[model samples]
Target: MMAMTQLQSGDRAKIVDLSRVSELVRRRLLDMGVTEGVEVCLKCTMPLGGPFMIESCGQCLGIRRSEAMRIQVERV
Candidate 1:
């Protein structure tokens, strides 16, 4: 298992667990369709450490570092 934020571009992973920080943060990610057992791909990262793009469920989503840190994934 690895942190989603640590994945390199083009790598694929499956969401396994979420950080035990707060329900609000966890719910926010779930609302965006980032749930456990879902497959996600690291597409690209914006220059200058901005939000990174991930592909999942036929949609591409941009997530910031703070948000990404709350998600844990396993390489696939």
Candidate 2:
């Protein structure tokens, strides 16, 4: 498993786990449909290694590199 942030643009992955981010952050992410076993696609990344855009559950989400690093996923 690797961080979702490590995935290349257009890569698809299945979320397996999430690191110990803050409880509120975790809840927020989960509320946005980023739970385990869900599949996500890396739609885009900022030019300077900033936030990443991911598609999941028919929704697009923007997350920071630090946040993405807590989301563990396996390539699909």
Strongest candidate by lDDT: 2
Worst 10 residues of 2 by lDDT: 17-26
RMSD of 1: 1.8
Candidate 1 wrongly placed segments (more than 4 Å): 21-25
Q: For residue 32, give model 2's deviation from the true position in Å.
A: 1.5
Error of 2 at 40 (Å): 0.4
For residues 1-76, write the lDDT of model 1, one tens digit per residue.
8788899999999999875536876776688887899999999988887887999988888878767776889999
Go through the candidates in order and give each one's C-alpha lDDT: 0.84, 0.87
RMSD of every prediction: 1.8, 1.2
Model 1 lDDT-worst window of ten: 19-28
Give stretches of model 2 more than 4 Å off: none
Residue 31 error for model 2, in Å? 1.0
